[model samples]
Target: MSASVKSPRDPSTSFDDDVWPDSTDVLIMGGGPVGLSCAIMLAQRGVDVLLVERRDFVFRFPRAHLLNPRTMEAFHDMGVAGDIYGATPAHDRWRKAAWYTTATGPGRFDGMKIGDVPAWGGGPDAERYRSSSPRAFANMPQLRLDPLIHRHALAAAPGRIRSRQEVVAIEQDSESAVVSVRDVVTGELRTVRARYVIAADGGRDSADLLGIELEGPRDMREVVNYHVSMDLSAWSEPDALLGHFLHPAGGARRRGTIQALGPTHYNRDSEEWLVSVAAWMVEGDPDDEAALFASIRRMLGLADDHEITMHSMTRWSYHGLVAKQFRDRRVFLVGDAAHKHPPTGGLGLNSGIQDAQNLCWKLAAVLDGQAPDGLLDSYQAERRPVVAWYTAHSLENANRHPPIAEALGFCDDEAAGFRGLEVFVSETPEGEAMRARVAAEVAHNAHDYSQLGVEAGYHYWAGALVPDGTPVPGDPSDPVTFHATSRPGHHLPHVWLDSATGGDGGSVSAHDLIAAAGLTLLTSESAAPRWRAAVAAASGNMPITVVAIADDDAAWTAVRQIDDDGALLVRPDRKVAWRAARLPADPDAELTAALETILRGGDAPAGDPAEPYLRRIRAAANVLVR
Candidate 1:
């Protein structure tokens, strides 16, 4: 197969909704990594979901190889991170990404040590991630990962995932969305009425139906990817780990320029590999298979006798686009349908997974009548800005690569010319200076690998969150370094603490204590009974659980940064919704008011002059009791 292979039919061009044959709380329109993730998240909350995909089976092309720590955390919450980890290549072999001139011999470039273990997050930063969450980043290509995600999603909600099913048309009213779907295998058409339609359909028809445009640059660059399987053990040292292959400029056998992708295979010991040739790095048509093969062979410095089986070759244009709106009435867009970015920072799939995590719980809450419908609007308000930041960061990273090319003597500087391989391989003074410059450039590129800040430090403001009038100092827009904080709207900082179970019990992550469905309240040991009493007084009215850490837990206290007598309200997505530095004099009144405001989507109640907020709260309580 090659890049010219056609995709499956468009699933949102026609509507024949004459017969209604199905109904579900959520109708997921795509079963890629993000759709599967949305299904798992919703199913775990006991939300009835139907996931449909146009493709009959999972695609085998390897894409999005790096699953960042934040993505792994979502998998951990879904209880499937371990399964994903088992499928990934060994971390020790793939974590340290470096640049090599060729696959064989002593062609290692000096200062080519781009970063340490967890190529996405280097040594010290990776250690910080370990302390915060149980999951670590891993390198598992989409070909292997999709099936695992599919299996887990199926297991989470049996008989709900439907393959070869395409959604052809969607129309939504105030109450529900009616979708017309066609069975790809049988040419059968059916109608489904879903309370909400989640369009994770990979940036195609669904986005157009909702009149949403992916607004940004789509022609940043073009690149050709070659998926192959070949034995390269002769070129690697025993137990050797290989990552990025930088085929520097000017080699006798080289056809223009090419670079082999590392981390696509299990390791150098494995036969599976995916090599890429960026169009910006070369001067020939990337779609030409013969030219691509010549470049690959030249980059490998291998003999024609070597065997390499080609699986597929595909050309993709790099993009940095996000949908104009993530939601439209009863339909919502997620995953690639919501945003698209180049793979430079590996943010695309991970951001989509997190988007699913964020929206699913809110949907579950609204569908279950635990929270008002207005809460749904916060999804766009919170996610759009964060995704926009990620988009900019990825584009910046892609632009940064040209500087590396310039340092390696490949740019259009006629005065410098092509230095050839000798600059990186030879030990002469000129070679040593080139290595130093390359090393300095590599050091400047550290943000690409050590992006702990981007992985964990995102915060939400003005949506589904109540500010306590405390000003939180702003950090850098990019992920240079992470600052741990439990401020309102920030994610709850992770800390290890002794279980409130007793004096001689095991320890648990503060993250582990958050409610999977409702709001969670954290208080000091002395205020436990008061908070519990306040919650009980408001019982049947609000969904909340109270946990009090012993005042003596210094580590937990410092990380949370809250006074012993204060309280912190955590949302289902593990973000701080509100916090009180100290107990309010009227805890019950304060707690009731907060719950009412949050449930109304962080707005005061409407239309009633007689205690509208209180009246709505009572009405919801009465409904719950009924």
Candidate 2:
């Protein structure tokens, strides 16, 4: 697990089709980052999983970017964190999210400088961000991210991934789901049966085949992505990764975005970039390369002599949609198949990664006969609402764009816009006022890039979790705040603890204890023996383990929120399944009952998980006090 890395196998590498297996424990469709992640983590958990992707390899275009810290923690659990970290530019290279009037200046009075803000793991909140988790964020695009995830999936189970094979139809009965797959090149069909199916086909092809109906808007907005190789070092900021180029004549409604697609080395010096613009109603042809080039030159202030090489211009839709439900008997929807979002907050891919993480363990438990079939119901209960909040938050982030443009005087009124633009960077009192206004607005955009609470401290209720009757902790409504607690149905607060009470013990995050991929019973040293005895007597050979924190370990002692004899039962996904304030009269029976409740399916607290978060989403998105 050191920094040393082994070359991962390209997902395009062929698996033996001559001996296609007709059965698997889990069949994952779509080999994008989410599907590949599912395959890797499920295989790591000893599940018989097979992955099928229509494309021979992952698309090279930079699609989803900015793997948030929460996703990185999940990636760490999947054992691909090291590779993910190794594959990207340094966190500092692309840590600044800067805004500008245009790619070039209109005046010498800070003309191009609208304002600046730190992104990812930078700025005033950096320490607070690091305090919650052991892992940091990554800025690699999906084009580079997919193969790293795929490599681990292949390494975990060779011959498990089949490319160029597409799922045609799925029929589920009482036992397993029968899937009809077609080999794209040969036009031959293959039949496979699986206890569970993960539809990661981005919802386009697989949702209908499985008789699933999607709710929410479709084709909400059009975003054109231009992949081009250009030298932009002249106006590029040293520490910025995303450059917001608002047109000098363009209003608050329209602005151009430039994202660095660093192939290698530093992102500030990346040779390739993804330039995009959004339009509710476009006038010209959607694929007008000439118009796009003219816009790019206008945004970047490219000279006629400067050569611009256009690689490809992709026109994609921005829809804020979520599936009605995640579970359809034995079939589950994940990734784009489950929901889609506007690419403002970078929550789409991260949400999908977590969806797979939440479901795989439950699947393993049921397949191993450790949990009842009812456990599967928790998938939608626990995951969908989080996606709902992400959808709302992403829209909120998208909406932040216009206000920033307005502050910079990018408007339709020609004279008013020019006057406001001139005063924005002027040295007079009016100029100072405009400068301050733009600065404050640009800083507010931090919620789009560095909103820690939504990504890491997402609150969950119901489904697989056994919620103790307690009020929700911290500011659940604040999208920018995260407070670590050990309450049941909540993510276990992370704290570094020593292996032994002696001062010489090795340090590790609380997450490392659950590395074995099962329910972990965390108890203090004084209570360890009793918890161990209880687990031994009532585990029923389930994949449960008990760990004791030393009495001398202050970190665990502070966050546990339980008595010396109490314990917390954590699911494989790292959420607290149950909490015992103190030793039960019959520890064995108490432990057994908790397991039965979780495995047999317990009713979550009554409420729509999206309601409270939606209220917070509607609230002003400001930097919360950590």
Candidate 3:
């Protein structure tokens, strides 16, 4: 049968002003995307969950613009990606990362176009992105994404989210744990207990409650975001996702960048924007509003009186901090509580959503008596390596920026001026050399922009999945390329499957065939009869679905890494738990052994040997930790 497509529903549930529950099956701290994702994912699995947030309202900061394909695929499974896709701007509205000497006015430089490249996973590379996954990277910011996720979370778990509530205290033993949550609005205290606690609190306190130390660099550097609104429709601005306004004297701190907020056009409709500039440029002892206005005008090459409205000025730091351990007894850290990264790669949020996805299923299985406590340990084993690699990756991306200035012949302090840029763009031989150098540097920096491998190709070397002992497919070291395979511990390769008889005539992603809350056994027609019978016999109290390929799904079967008479078992999170290359003589016994290894942690690592490599990766980062 074709995979069933779930229709969207109204998230009609409300939790504001509702009384607190004394207990739940799961307690999720923090109401950011990660916590909400945890609540939604867990509730859909029939688990009672309570999500707590310290803020009284959904945060409106317009941060984290890129939703990578892997994160989008997970959101698609949760039923919220459709609405996000519908609301996103068209491709042309945010396709390029174009650099400029300035946007307009040409006060110091003649508004020369420095360079251009495709941003995110679109434009000339669109096919590469499309072929890798079923979804596109949405250039949706949190100002739009968070509220939608909050609404879906309400629907997924009605009367379960409590804003203006914070986890003040937490203590856990082997049996159950207690968390003291305080109502920030009413100054009232409430106590709740849960079988498990997830600290997705974005480095607020839950990790502190467990006394977990953050390993690696602390404060790398500081940058300021100026949320301003202006009418740039009169300027000669072209389409771009991000506009890099460059000038040699600007230094790394003063080089300005503009992020498109969007409504079909960059200048005509993206009236609001977030600007990155040096903190010192806008900082003054007496608060020089006139000078600040001038600095903004100079950055955009606008005249002195350009009528820009300043909404908010936020100053934040970049860090490469990872919690010493993600799991401690019954409390597990998810999202920022577990790891922090610089925004250079726009991966902080994408990795957080994936963290929730990885953790919630293991939680559901254990709570339902379907898995062992040892299975929970796999969360750290699978995810910590990713956390370490990304921390280094993001810091490397941040360091890649200043070299662009150098490549444009900004080496000497005296030569770093508008005249230097003019000569560099000339048709002279010196200009050609400078252009080549700039292109090489920009291409190097582009790794941060289109890291499809880091986004999708990441896998576990030591986790819950039963390894086939074959070498792990794909270059785990390459952050730009993704190699699809059905190796255990890797995401099941995505392929469109034709419908089975007595089913809908449409084709769907093989990933969609797996249930959100169960095990799914995918077998070919040649192996269908025994696999179905074996699943029926072995499913017992667990939710397991059996799907037989329609014999013509060459695309789907080719990536299975299994024989026509073999089968693959997919977990609730769509991870391939085990694969049988060929049908065994006793089908029931084979299926039973696979489930035992997966759910019971039959072949998981005995210790955290991956940590030494992770520590080395962290130490090698070019980050400045205070």
What TM-score fits each model? 0.85, 0.92, 0.92
Per-model CA lDDT versus the true structure: 0.70, 0.77, 0.75
For candidate 3, write residues 238-308 as lDDT tens digits: 67768777676565332667887764454334878877765555545414566666667777777777888
lDDT of 1 by residue, 110-226 (tens): 213222223554455567767655567876778778888898887886777888888889988989999998888889988889999999998677966777877666655667777
Q: Could you give the C-alpha RMSD of every candidate to the true structure, in order shown?
A: 11.2, 5.1, 3.5
Over 37-136, each residue of candidate 2 has an lDDT whose tens digit, in order, gives 8888777767888888888875668888888877898898888888878877755657778877656544443226677778777777688777778788
- Tell how far residue 437 is off in model 2, in angstroms: 2.4
State in Å the error of residue 398, model 1: 1.0
Clashing pairs in 1: none
TM-score of 2: 0.92
lDDT winner, 1 or 2: 2
Identify the runs in model 2 with alpha carbons over 4 angstroms from their true place: 1-15, 91-93, 105-111, 265-267, 279-285, 498-506, 611-626
Q: Which of candidates 2 and 3 reaches a greater lDDT? A: 2
Candidate topping lDDT = 2
